[model samples]
Target: MQFYPKGREQRLSIHHPSVRPRRLAVLRAAGVNLLLLQFLFLGLFCYIFGSLFQQSTHIHQVNVLFVDYDGGAIGEAVRDAYKKLEGPGFPTIIERSASDYPQPGSIEGAVCDINYWGALYTTANASNALTAAFAGGSAASNYNKNDVLTMVWNEARYPTVVDSALETTLKTLSQSARVVYSKVNGKQALQNLDTSDSTTMAIFYDPWTLASTNLQPTSQGSRLIYNTLVIILIMIQEFFYLGTVNGLYVQFKLYTSVRPHRMAIVRFIISAVYTLAGSLCTAGAIWAFRSGWQVNGNQFALSWAVLWLFAHLNFLVLDVFTVWLPPPYVPMALITWIITNITSILLPFELSPGFYKVGFALPAHAVFQVLIDIWSGGCNPQLYYALPVLFVYEILGAVLSSVGVYRRAHYASIKAESDEKACEERVAAAVLQQQEVQLVRQETLRDAEDSRSSNEEQETRDARPRRGTVTTIKDQEELVDIIRREMSRPTVESPEDRRSTTGPSFSLPFTE
Candidate 1:
């Protein structure tokens, strides 16, 4: 027999028994859902990826200070050279007065404090030293070319941006300064120098040199993982831990026995404890392979505490999402969260578009700055700002997560009550159906008995019964036996009853 009726439209082939209308309807719905999800993620995930697009075009926002303390020809030549090279796709060179940084150490402080991506300074009395050396005295033999200019920067602030962008640009500028100094001043200075003094002549020939000072060198390669891979690892750990906790709640039916508020407290405490332990391990791992870093108790404690806060905040945010979103959509939120946070810390926000200033308020950027501060031996003094951001995230996450938990619990309770009422209604309907079946069986038996008695009465009245008079007693007896066998066997209700009796609905285990 044909499974589908004739003339009915069929999208799927008729060769398989499973290719039916109801199953096709389910497949169509699932296909639509999948298509919609693909478009949805395409829009959202692409936006996340676009955060880093064309980042090089915005490099001008990164500032490097240039100060000319030596009011001599050498300083003037270098400044003019930089001015000629100034354009887009390079760091902005902001020239400041030498008096703004009188002490040599002041430039170092400015670079280390992130006031500038780097600094270039012409040393004080550099022109005097050069002119004296040109006079062919012992000063010429002792003249140090490196004393002419100094370049200061902190590499540990952002290793990639410094090594690839800022450091390269500064070195190029330094080379240009040297070349400009020679072309503009070399001919004039040579005309005045004593040619007989060969040592003085050689010093004059190679007069311009750049003294490079990297305040905080990030030599350790492992630390690179902190802002990128390690953050992702922590997120994975939190996700699995949350899954385990939810599994336990469902496995033990804790939602029924535990109060929602109490459960929220328990989750918070446990998450804090777990994050502390994980943070210790993470910090210890760094210390174990520190590779010449100056590790100390204070740094370790600070890093551990910051990591714990960061991880716990992640957990709370995921908690809020998982509680409020459908299960199928939670992974999407997870992807969005990871990419956004990672993007915020991946590059120096200074080099990003103005729209990306939101990174300043994100937790990963703050945590990364703190870590850099700790590792660089307090080079980054932004902790006052960074720490407060983390604390604010912590406070907001805690409050929102707690409320989400309570709301989830309230919804679960209401759903459970409704399910219980539905179950009761189903049970009552089953009982009524059974009673109706029994009543129908009793009426069938009574009709059979009356038929038998009527046939017996007809036989007594005529002393003989016609063959076609009515249904025979044997037939009545057979009908009665069939009814008895059917009623004795199990009662089978209609299709609606079977559907309704499938099972009790269980609450989702996402939260309390």
Candidate 2:
């Protein structure tokens, strides 16, 4: 059986004629709010999705350094082939003189340093090696065609973008270069080579191919989490902990007992400690499933420290919003934060619209870049800018969070005082009303007694002075004095009274 009132048992449909005005008004307000929220989130999320809008069109913007050391038919063919694909909608291949990068190692260092998206280098002896193979010299039998040209890139910098756009473009350019070489030198090389030998014929068929050297190679899979998914998980963990803390405040009357300033400090400390532990776990998991990555203990520790800083910054940033924004809007703020940062780190900002360049200052992008640098054995030099940006965000979060704590405390104090004053006023009014009722009852009893006394006096008609209006006036004055004395005295509130007055520690922006 239902233990509620009869009114609760009565159910009404949405279009019921007997629905009350209050409920109907509430429903209409909720419906309007849902519609408005839909519009707001739709626009916000779409803007986030647009971060990758027509990104392929920007592929040509990537700068690739091309230095052909071999100034022979093969090198010239590759250079001309790359120049052909340079007009629009392709990677820009910038040709540098062979003398400029005298050592091949220097070119690889440039790519690792992120000076260019990728680099193509033809060995100084590429044409000489092929010519030797065709001449059937003693060293021609040991000629390695793979050493003719080299393509150097750091795939770990941004695997997805590199694999999809830059790497693909470079591979296509290499194919075009091969075709160009065949057309220019195929007939001449066939005439010069000894066709009687099977090995020589094989060399004539496939003269040269681009040899790839990934300066910073990434894992095949799973390690991708540290760059992308782990960041979101850290953010989610922070929100989950915050929700639990809010629940504790609700279940217990901690707001009434504890000072707001102290509460804020404790909150920050707990959140920091929580984030630190979570970051450690995250770092440990990464180390466990590292998939044979060649990272040293020192590098792992440094990366873990960076991850902790990143997570703490996220907590602080979210804390600022939680204490200021309304509960309903907090989720929206969360989604916006996650989406904005996630977009920045997913791809290089250079390949996106100019507007997305702001990713340089975002927390996720900075941390991701730093982590990639560390994991790739310090390939990219991004720590200088990334570290400072994170520190700035930390300072901002700290200052704003402190201010919010002070303001919330001030609001709580004011509300507590107002509630106490209201309670006192209500008590005073009730006491005055009760005193008046007793005064009237006394008057009625005195009137009945006087009437009886007057009948007795009529029988005796002697020396008895009758009690009159003066006596009644004295009693009324005495009662007024007592009430005045009680009203003048200050009332002390019990602990229960204060608890009843105090509200939740964290209030929404729209609510108290």
Candidate 3:
């Protein structure tokens, strides 16, 4: 036997249709519609294009071999300068064999072919043919070659002028020293073999060396930070997208009378699943095709932490939006987009001028920066500091969403109660009005019958003798008495009244 009443069962079957079967059907339909393929294509495009764009723009340290052919004092000085440039923070320097000289695909220039900004080259010769070659010159005709040639030639010419100036200055100093020595000692003693010593000359570089003057080093950290920031920003957008979708679904279900807390829980689960899946897909695609994106186990752990925090932050924000702004998904979506874009996730925060620093303090900004730092082998002291900020945002979002859900649910309950009370009041008023009308009709009918009986008795009295008229009056009085007795009898209640009294007896009645 069916457990529920027929009407109730029908209503339940109509309103709470089998969601699992419907969901399965929808999934199958979506699969057949090829929407999944579109999503996959979009995801792949984002991953691949984003990775390539990041790699092209972001500068990083790369391994390079620097062969020094110039063993002379100047060459040795330049080589020593280059060697001093090697540090733990910069690119790794590798030594190459003599055979490795003039090697093809050598990263021995100022800029790598791959745009890594790291290069390796030999510097043993004072006139570096490789430098000239890098400067875009033919090895055959070395004169008047390239821009680098002109620069280096000009640099060499300046040193010659400097040497000449130094010679003049030293001659004056030696002459002064000699004059002092002559004044201190005898001129004859100073004149013995001092001519040879006086003829001796030496030159030294000025306070600023050529190596210091020519070299302008860029920071590896800056490029890494910027590129990583862009990638993380994109990831933040993805997180927000997924979170908003899940939140909207949850909010729609709740609007249909599903439990808000349960819906929230389900939304969180779906969000986590989507986040994990997307992250894995991104990581896998990058690993398979783009090997340059480096991540150690520790760094990976940090990245995951960053991703998790970002996901939760997005989820909370979207949940709050969903609760506060239901029905029109477009407005919420536009608002979210505006907020995200303004947070400096889509563009460089520094480019935002006065508000950049403040924008960077937002949850999306903090999370993106943290992810960039983790991915690109950099560190942000502010990331640790910003954790509390993100936590606060999350807390506020959760509290506000909870409050909104509670208020909405309470309003729905109150509305339902009000509607039920109004329904009962309408029914009761209709029943009472019907009963009054029936009583009025009965009273009118009884009066009409009494009038008709009196008329008939008068007619009979007129048709008989004068004595017969008195008897007719007695009969009429008796008829009137009988009618009064019938009218005095208690009336039975209507079926509707009995039902109204019994229907809600077991339930608490609502007062309008």
Candidate 4:
């Protein structure tokens, strides 16, 4: 998802951020990621999204609103026939709205909501009108005035797939109506309707001939843009986004000593080269599978060159935001892709709401017009208008990219870094002051506890009963003298002791 710093190893060895990848080293790394590493986005775009448009050109469910006003056998028969007709893939969802012929000019607005591809209606007395033709009236008889199946279509609602599908559906309904009418009238003459020689099939039974006003006319190949070029461009732009996001790794680029403008130039070169290769591959696939070799291959090349130019311009424009407003790149890409690709390209402006025209400023829109002009042999003449708009985009991108570069230069230089270092030093000083305050408080608590214990010991010693408290100070000294003298005195002579012993002989209980 992201490119981490490649210079991390070097940064660890040498603490200076200046020891970084040189200009060319950064460019080489970028080129590898841009051209070689980007194939996954390319493959995904081609294989997944490209295959999507190729397969999804046709609507899976063709919605049909059967508005029958005739109240006749022909209308009833066509309704029954439509139900029986089912083909492979998404079946047509038919909403059978039976009514008498809607008021003139009212059908167009009713179908404008575009929920259905087309509508089939019948005029009054559809059976009576077909009766004349069944009675062997002129095969060229006016089928328009008679009861005939009418097919109404809103060409602006969808592209050619729906257009052709609507036509085919109506034709099928017409055939069913014809067969049912012939059988009900017992006209065995019409049984040969399937024969190649049958004239009624085209002249009388054909719905286009039945009611000419019913089918709205549309220009040929109008839908080709939606199914082909638009889808291809969308996929290509999706592929381009992966490479462009590399611009978002500003910190890595900044650490690597690559200047923004220089990096932008490298990016432009790499993008142009990859764009050339991708554009060729895309054009080849489209030509081989869709257009074939009939069209000039030169036009594809021409269109691709212009497409590449616009795509790169778009990348540059996006890069401007990435450099200046880096954080929002992911959401910015999503929002822009949805708005530009969905509103303008996938949903043709003609088929989309009026606000979709805002996407004309998108490079894809202008490039799509140019591509269309090239593919369609210059019929649209959008080259004049589209090219100017694209040129304006390119110019605007260049200016904004330069502004982004200037902004980066202002931030990434030594002056800014010096200021940052000074700010960090101030913050470190403040933290050291806090640590000193805590150490002082801890030392103060230890000293206070030591002083308190010393005081308590001194107080205990003073409170204990000393010899001075037991006797007066002078008397205590005399007592000590008397004790010392008594220790020095020897035993007295034994005369008294002998006399006491002789006298004690008279005592009965005297010890021997």
Scored by lDDT, the top model is 2
Candidate with top TM-score is 2
CA lDDT for candidate 4: 0.55
What CA RMSD would you report for each candidate? 10.0, 7.2, 23.5, 32.0
User: Which digits, one per residue and each the tens of the lDDT, describe model 2 over residues 432-459?
Assistant: 6655766576567555656566767454
lDDT of 3 at 265: 61
Off by over 4 Å in 4: 1-264, 291-293, 414-512
* Candidate that beats the other on TM-score, 3 or 4, i.e. the better one: 4
TM-score of each: 0.77, 0.81, 0.38, 0.42
Question: Which residue pairs in model 4 clash with each other?
Answer: 69-99, 126-147
Candidate 1 Cα errors over 4 Å, as ranges: 1-37, 44-49, 131-137, 192-205, 422-512
1-512 per-residue lDDT for model 1 (tens digits): 65545446555665467757656765776676667668867876676666677777777888988888888877787777778777767789898998898877998888888888888888888888887888787888778888888888887887866776787777777778768877887777777798899878777767766788888666687867767898888888888898787767655656766887898899899889988898889888988887886567898888898899999998888888878888767877787788788888878877666677788888888899998898778888989989999998888889888887677677777876786677556555555565566556545655565546677755544542333233344444455566546544645578979866758533332221
Q: How far is candidate 2 from the true structure (C-alpha RMSD, Å)?
A: 7.2
What ranking emerges by lDDT with the best candidate at the front? 2, 1, 4, 3
State the lDDT of candidate 4 residue by residue for 1-512, as single tens digits. 33545434344433345534454455665675456325645643553343234232233356656666767676777756666665533226465544432553455444544445566677766556555544444633555533366666644233454445556656766776567655664455355333343434444444334453332333445345644455546444734563454644443545236666776666567656765676666666665555223357687678678756766676666666556654524343444454445435554443334455676776666776676556545534566778998889777877787676667666667654775577556555555565566556545645565556777756644653353243334444554456446643655658868665634212111111
Tens-place lDDT digits, model 3, residues 399-469: 77656666666776777677667755655555556556655654564556555677785664455444444
